[model samples]
Target: MDILVTGILLGGTYALIAMGLNLQYGVARIMNLANGEILVAGGYFAFIAYTATQLSPILTIFLVAPLAFALNSLIYRVMLQPLVNRAKSRGQLESDSILATFGLSFIGVGLMLSFFGGDYFSYSFMAVPVEVLGNTYGANRVLSFVMAVLICGALYLWLNRSRAGLSIRAIGTTPASARLVGIDVKALSAFTFALGGAVTAVGGALISTYLTLDASTGVVFTLKALIIVIMGGVGDVRGTIVAALLLGILETLVATLLDPGLTLAAAYVMFLGILLFRPQGLFGKKPT
Candidate 1:
């Protein structure tokens, strides 16, 4: 029962992470390798804020979100947006993004190592535990789960029900057509990327509270994000949530049943199996 509940909670968290990736890769049509770094950056911001200001963790979002948004905008303006200006498919542009993003990841890791050092760390200041269905869980974990769900829900509403959100999707699917209809593609892309970064910042703050983290956390998180996005499908929101949950549960079960190292390997193998059978992704639209 604990396993089941924990897995469900973890899956919800991964969904938050994946949804942030979706905004960039799915809606903005940018393959952002920096997605994970953005998450960690947010985490670090919260960490520093907690240490310096003694502010409540929940209040940290106000500062973290804006900083993350600005940093994301800078990254796009410098690295990604240039590749986007050239006429090319996602494959071509993503190739460049991969290299740039990986480089960014490496640099970020190096900087963190230089400044923060190599140490396994966690913050437990704002902890609160709760009981559900005769099961007990961390208050921080519950808060994290609730925050993830609320942010994702709000984002879905914005994208699906709001005019701006509809415009974001329309522009990504066919920018040429959207432009012909007078949508501001450049502004929209920046806005979407910033919004995605803000969401990731929230995820990052949750990470600081829930997991032991260091400079290398971003690298692993990025790979995990990749698995979720690929399994979920490129540019599919619903697919991402389902995929993150499935992977989250599967990973949890595997860790329980087998050696820890083998768990990731097994998950990758499962991912490959799914890709072989349904390359368009489970919830992805069939290619034309």
Candidate 2:
């Protein structure tokens, strides 16, 4: 029971972490390697706000979201758009984006190291214990889970119910067909990319409450997000949430029954299995 509850709580945040990457890669068709850096930056913003102004880290979401959106939009326009325009095919664009964002990740890391130094940062926020199902858990973790669920729920609704979201889905489904239907693929792609960054940053803010983070740790998160996105169907919100939960449960079970150090190895083993057997993802349809 304890493991189940803890895993569910952990998976909730994981869902938020992966959802942004899903949007960027699935909708915008840009495989951003710097996504983890963006998430770390959001955590930094929350840390700064909490330390300097005594502001609640939760409230920092509002500050981080718009800032991340604007910066990401600028990044897409200045750095990625040219690549997008020049690529001869989707494969070429993906290759170019991987290289470009890989460099950007290094730059982001350097800037963070310069400003914050290479030290772990964490803050005591809502550290009180809360009783749940005959067990105790940190109040912050519970709150974070609740917030993640709400945010993901809202995003799902927006994507399924709104016209703009329909267009975004159309592009993700078939970009060429979307273009034929008069969708401004470039502009919308940029928007989706910026929105993905904002979502990722917000996830960082939620996570900072419970996780100790440093400048260089973003890569770990990026890989985790990528794994979740792939394990779930790309662009499939429902699949992302389910895959995250499964991963969370798997990690929890492994850490509790085996060695905590093996949790990451377990994740990799699962990822490998998925790739070998279900490259199209658990929920993704096989290509024709």
Task: State each model's CA lDDT, in order.
Answer: 0.79, 0.94
Candidate 2 has a TM-score of 0.98
Top candidate, metric lDDT: 2
RMSD of each: 1.7, 0.9
Candidate 2 residue 236 Cα shift, in angstroms, is 0.7
> Which digits, one per residue and each the tens of the lDDT, describe model 2 over residues 235-276?
999999999988888999999999988978888988999999
Encode model 1's per-residue lDDT on 1-288: one tens digit a residue: 776777777778888888888788876777677677778777887888888888766789778878888888888788778888883776887787778778888888888778888886667765766897699988877787888888778877878898898889898688779888779989898888877777777888876777778877786777777788888887677788888878877887878888666757866876798778988888777789
Indicate the TM-score of model 1: 0.93
What lDDT score goes with residue 247 in model 1? Answer: 80
Every model's TM-score: 0.93, 0.98
Candidate 1, lDDT over the whole model: 0.79
What candidate 1 gets wrong by more than 4 Å, as runs, is 87-89, 126-128
